[model samples]
Target: MISEATQAVITHYERRHEFRGDVFGAQPYANYGYWARPDLTLEQASEALTDLVAASAGLGQGDKVLDVGCGYGAGAVKFVKRYDVDAVTGIDVTPVRIASGQDYIAEHSVADRITLQEGDATAMSFGDESFHKVVSVECAFHFDTREAFLKEAARVLVPGGTLALTDIIPRRGVDPSAYLTGETTNQSQVCLDMPANAYDADVYADLLRSTGFEAVRIESLLEWTRIPFADALARVAAASEGERAEQISRMATRIRQLIELGEDYVLVTARRS
Candidate 1:
């Protein structure tokens, strides 16, 4: 149900991302944000690859942009620097993440061009067709409902605008309950992805079409994460063949695990009709 508590945990972790601590135990992404991750350097390469591949998506200068579930604002920074986007606004339901995102913007000296706020996906306060481009990075799955999220996204997009979403989706009928929510937390209240979610590539295409979007494009390159994960593990293994041989083997195991566990963090881009 994407309860407020689960959102709180996400938000809290982001706040601690800049610090060296652990609050969510040994969760995967619970490590020190991407910046502090042992794999950040390689991960950035992956993001750059995606940026280059999608560079022609037309995020022009002076465009008003909205980033849903901005999460520490890494992608927002990438967009401003790579795409010439003028003004970027990132909104999340978590105050901690909002604060952390804002801090990241200020630290990077992009405060004038970027902003972060706490917002609800089902109901944004922006005017009709307020943004020229809307993008979410691996975060839209947290929206209240797939339909409501798309509807509100459409409401905030102008004619000929675009919505590029990179979110985690379900695989098949696999019960995500064991992986999603945890003790003292219940995200199932709103997480639509279940036992088996095929990243909803087709479903999102259909929803975008129904919500006044045209030229929908769905790319299900789910192995991108594994590429970086394996690369990072290789780096770890390279440090010391004997010392890291076992660790590298574990990393390889983990990369395969990412492929098996998260085969749904897909990228879907839809243009507003």
Candidate 2:
């Protein structure tokens, strides 16, 4: 059963789905694109972020992968095509995204290699050791409790299987609750639903270790992710008009607020021990 918090998150995304294609480009990615270079378009940068996560997970040929919180199965399809992964099973709680992902999978002609289903990440249905790699991109913070999802990821992966993800973590000396309860714009308010246990880099690494993962590595990707994305959003807002422009402007503001709040955009990798 979906918790109230998870349902709220789903509702937020449901609303987002209406205009995500207009704002996030034609593809189905709902992530902060990794701006490897200044001139890359949003679609290219978004694909780059997915590639970064796949590389971090050490995805290999014939690997069976599980993507938790896979938004519209874009990353999963990318994994199968770009990384030569044998297959990818993507699970998400949002129904509309899953429906869209199914269409995306069919359109990409990878329906045989990818599966997108609506399901909870914190409690998965996969058997133990069912996958070789587990990945989540920018969606862990909304998982009700990221720690619980980590444990579940560990449970489903084969021994020594890798888990890689990008997440937002509060910087040292920052109080998450302050941001949660403070005044927020519409775009910012949607993200304030982050769980209490979402901790700093140090605590995050320790949490991974305690959750049956080892060789934990956490690297800040703020410069490549949120910073560039925010700049791009501002440009979009400036070039556009009407409600769409206002929405993009608010999103840019929210991204800036996160940066000012000392929130670190990080890429984390670990292996099941």
Candidate 3:
């Protein structure tokens, strides 16, 4: 369990938003689109999904997908509908997120294809080798330990299964404690009261390998950051009004602030051995 203090901060933060994961849950683009549009163009949505699907190439018609820290269940629902994958199970420790995702699945009639549960990453509630693909989109940051999260991920993933994730990775070689403190010590814009151990690309790769995952690949999200900071800022400022507007503006400001403090966006892919 996360520290009670941490959990309280997380609960407060998530309860404020309709979605669970911070803005840019998976793709900075659609993430940016909350303020940009209600009906994002298919083109916009597909680009974000390109990286998402490419990471899980082996998933087939009947394969199951496990999404840890599933956020609002966008990737989960996408996989079921687009690939006709047999099932998508999304789990989050945040109760509100599970509830919101449940409502989304029910409202969209994707209930047959998607499952959302209140679960933990450090101690997953699933059978060994239960899923063909495992994904945690920008949510693993909440995990208190690297080994715990990787162990649970590897335990539940089938041999030769794939794991894909896009989250804030520390810029290579930087000490996280330097910039992480105070408000950051609680719930910084980048992560929620989370001191990241797998932020470094090499460190993340090493952890995956140790957990029996092979061929791990970690890439810094340099290209994505260039356009998003400005776009996100502009969109939030333009779309927000009254209390909601003020909240979004503050959140957007914090995201950019964290990005500036550390070049911390990373995309990782690995296979369960």
Candidate 4:
């Protein structure tokens, strides 16, 4: 079962994105696109991040994938269209967004290749070795603990299958109270609540290895995080007005400070051995 706090976080995303159109509104990819190079546009960078994860997973035609924490099924749709994957099953704790995702998939006419449903990451409803690859993008921190999710991923993936995830991991021992938690410690968490589940890159890799996964690799792609986030904030400031603009500008400044202090977003991959 999804915890009340996590459910709130999912609902928060649903509400924040309710106004966006179907094109790029379902996912935060455009806002925080991965900048492999300086010239890439927000959409290009966002698609590239999906490509990066696909490369890490060695995805191919006829392979089945499980997408845990899939948000509104945007990334899953992209995967089916871009990669030749036979099918992608997406599950999210947020039930409200599932209908929207289903509508989008039907509108795009890719229903045969992608499916989205409301489900928890820690305890998924699937048989053993049900998928060839499992991917979760930038959403694992919301889990009560990554350990339970990783173990469940291992159980759901076939032997020698792959698991890939992108996450915003805090630097070890940093005071998360500075940015993650709100003005008060007991405040409701935001989508990017880092302190709620603090784990550095190394700790993540170690946990993956301990969870019966082998050849675990965790790479910090700070350039992607710092550049794209700054660019998005700049765009937000340019487009918004009043208190919303001010709020986003303040958020940009704090994120830059956190980056300088050693927090990073990373891509992690491993094989179930």
How do the residues 1-273 of candidate 2 rate in per-residue lDDT, one tens digit apiece? 778778878888888787665667788888999999999888889999999999999998999999999989889989998888999999999899999999999999999999999889999999999999999998888887898899999999999999999998888788877566535347424543565655899999999999999999999999999999999989988999898899999888977987897788999999999
lDDT of 1 by residue, 1-273 (tens): 455534654554454454312222221122112222343555454465336323535677888889887766766777787777988888877676677677777877888999888887777889998998887765565565656778888888998888886666655554455455432212112332322233346666787799788888876545554455565555655664563366456645644554566455556778888
Ranking by lDDT: 2, 4, 3, 1
In order of appearance, the predictions have TM-scores of 0.70, 0.96, 0.81, 0.87
- Where does the lowest 10-residue lDDT sum fall in candidate 3? 27-36
Q: Which digits, one per residue and each the tens of the lDDT, describe model 4 over residues 64-85?
A: 9998887767778878888879
Best by lDDT: 2
TM-score, structure 3 vs. true: 0.81
Estimate the lDDT of model 2: 0.88
Per-model CA lDDT versus the true structure: 0.62, 0.88, 0.66, 0.76
* Maximum-TM-score candidate: 2
Candidate 2, poorest ten consecutive residues by summed lDDT: 183-192
Ranking by TM-score: 2, 4, 3, 1
**Residues 1-273, candidate 3, lDDT per residue (tens digit)?**
566644754675465454323344343123322112334433353345444443445566888988877766666776776778899998877676677778777877899889999876788779998988887766566577656888998999889888887666668777676666646422334335556453678877888899989988887654454235445544755665576556656656666666666647666889899
C-alpha RMSD of each candidate structure in angstroms: 6.6, 1.5, 4.6, 3.1
Any runs in candidate 4 off by more than 4 Å, and if so which?
19-31, 172-196
